[model samples]
Structures are given as C-alpha cells and as structure tokens.
Target: MSNKCKTAISVIGIVLSIALLAISAVLAEEAIIRPALAVTFTVISAILVFVAIFYAAKIDYETGVYECRKCGHTFKPTFKAYTLGAHTLSTRHLKCSGCGEKSWCKRKNRRV
Candidate 1:
C-alpha cells in the first residue's frame, strides 16, 4: 500500500477511537444510555486504540528503514527490537547493525 494511504488509515482509526470514547463519556454523563452500554463502548474504544497503534507500528517496520547515527547505515530492525526499543515520533533507539552501537536512529520511509 502507499504510504499516504497507510497514514490516512492510521489517523482515521485513532480519530474514530477517540470519537467513540467521547460519545461513551457523554452518554454516561447525561444518563442517555445504560451505564453498562457506556462501559462497553469505552472498552471497545480502548481496544480500537490499541489495534490502531499495532497497525501503525507494523506499517512502520515494513515500509521504512532506520538510519543509524553511528555508521550512517540504513536497515530494518527486527520486530522485537522495534517494539521493545524506546522511540519518538521520528526516531527509535536501536542498535546499529553496522557499528554495533545503540543510538536514536532516524526513520525514513522507503520509496515504493
């Protein structure tokens, strides 16, 4: 899939999750819905958030490469490392395959 499409899907998923949570909160606050139903909606929204995160992570791993600061090498990390390592919006703490040093590596999306 294209990067833009992937990004759009991820954003939509997160937005939908947030909207559901807000709806649940409003329903519970106004007593418009049963408390049990509101609780169910909250749980579903939480699950959706998790699912969206997982999908985004998987896409990142598959469609992007991380550039190591130490050796300037670009490589894909193992899924385990990708998940376990600390990260920011644009970088991840990872061990460079070229230099065997850990650093915050910049993520670059690979051109399709």
Candidate 2:
C-alpha cells in the first residue's frame, strides 16, 4: 500500500481506540467521569475534524502532473494547497517547466 493509505489507516485506528476508551470509561465508572472530561473530548473531536479537513485539502503531491497549455510541454505543475479551494489554482499566471517561461499554462490537472 501507499504511504498515504498507511497514514489514513493509522489515524482511523487512533480515532476508533479513543471512541472505545470513552465508552469503556463511561460504562466502568459513572462517578469518576466529570463534565470537564466531556468538554475536553468535545474540543479534541472538533480539533480532529479540522485536522482531517486540512489533510484532505492538502494536495496529493505525487499526483499533480499537468502539461503546459501553450507550449504543450508535459511537466508537473507545482501542487499548492490553496485555502480557497481546488479551483484557486485556475488563476491566469502560470510558470512553465520546459523553458522556464512565465506564461499562462491554462491546462487543468488530471487526477492520476
């Protein structure tokens, strides 16, 4: 499997383990668990959700290969993780890879 798949599986396992621990703790001792612990868990869960979003938004660096539209030079366009979204890279300005030219390579990236 790829490194990405391995990392994803590890993250899923951690989340599942945390869930199981929470369930076991609640079932074992009703008095030991406090409201603060509940709030902490909530905060941790929210943070994890945001982290997941960031990870998903991160560019697949190994997969962003695109050709120059003008010169037809096949090259890998730099994969940038834009806060705006995937379409943010559709801007007019583009750097070419073949001749080191600063021209508009309007080609869209195909997922490989």
Candidate 3:
C-alpha cells in the first residue's frame, strides 16, 4: 500500500479508538452501561488506542526520511530516536548525522 494510504488508515484507527473510549466514558457516567461492562470497554478502547498509535509511529518511521536543515542531508533516524525526538507535524528535533548539529529537521516523503 502507498504511504499516504497507510498513514490515513492509522490516523483513522487512532480516531476511532479515542471515540470509542469517549463513548464508553459517557455511557458509564450516564449509567447507561453496567459498571463492569463499561470498565471492560474502557480497557479495550485504551488498548486499541495504544496499538493504533504504535502502528502509526511504525508507518511514519518506515515511510519517510528527515532532512537536516544545517547540511541539507537526508537520513532515516533510528526507531528509538524517531520516537523519542521532539516533533511538530512535519518537523522533528534531531542531530544531523552529517553536520552533527541539533535542529528541527523537516520530514520528506522521498526515499533516502
């Protein structure tokens, strides 16, 4: 599948998981669902959210390379670094492999 398609699916999964969790919370607060069942639903929804987020992170790491602003170098970060690094929607704080400068690097969909 295309990267865009994978990304979209992952995003949708996360959204659905959160929505399920919210619904469960509302049901429990309103006394519409049994407390035990609501707890079960909440746990299941939280697991789903974690799985979805992990999948999304995997897709992001696999599909794109980060470009260092300092040296105009493009590289793929280690999964640990990718996960731990601070980021905005399209940029991540990373140390450039070539220039050895730490900065917010832009994400590029193009292959490394």
Candidate 3 at residue 95, lDDT?
88
Across residues 1-111, which tens digit of lDDT does each residue of candidate 2 receive?
554674475567557656755664574466555767756665666566556545544433343444555677766655542232233355334566787766554534444
Task: Provide the lDDT at 82 for model 2.
Answer: 28
Residue-by-residue lDDT tens digits, candidate 1, 1-112: 6997998898888888888889889999999999999899899998988898788778778888999998899988999999999999899999998898999999999878
Evaluate model 1: give its TM-score. 0.92
Alpha carbon lDDT at 16, candidate 1 = 87
By TM-score, how accurate is candidate 3? 0.92
RMSD of each: 1.2, 7.1, 1.5
Per-residue alpha-carbon lDDT of candidate 3 for residues 5-103, written as tens digits (9 for 90 to 100): 999999999999999999999999999999999999999999999999999999998998999999999998888889999999999999888898998
Q: What is the lDDT of residue 22 in candidate 1?
A: 90
- Lowest summed lDDT across 10 adjacent residues in model 2 is found at 80-89
C-alpha lDDT of all candidate models, in order: 0.90, 0.53, 0.95
Candidate 2: residue pairs that collide: none
Pitting candidate 1 against candidate 3, the one with the higher lDDT is 3
Clashing pairs in 3: none
TM-score per prediction, in order, is 0.92, 0.40, 0.92
Measured by lDDT, the strongest candidate is 3
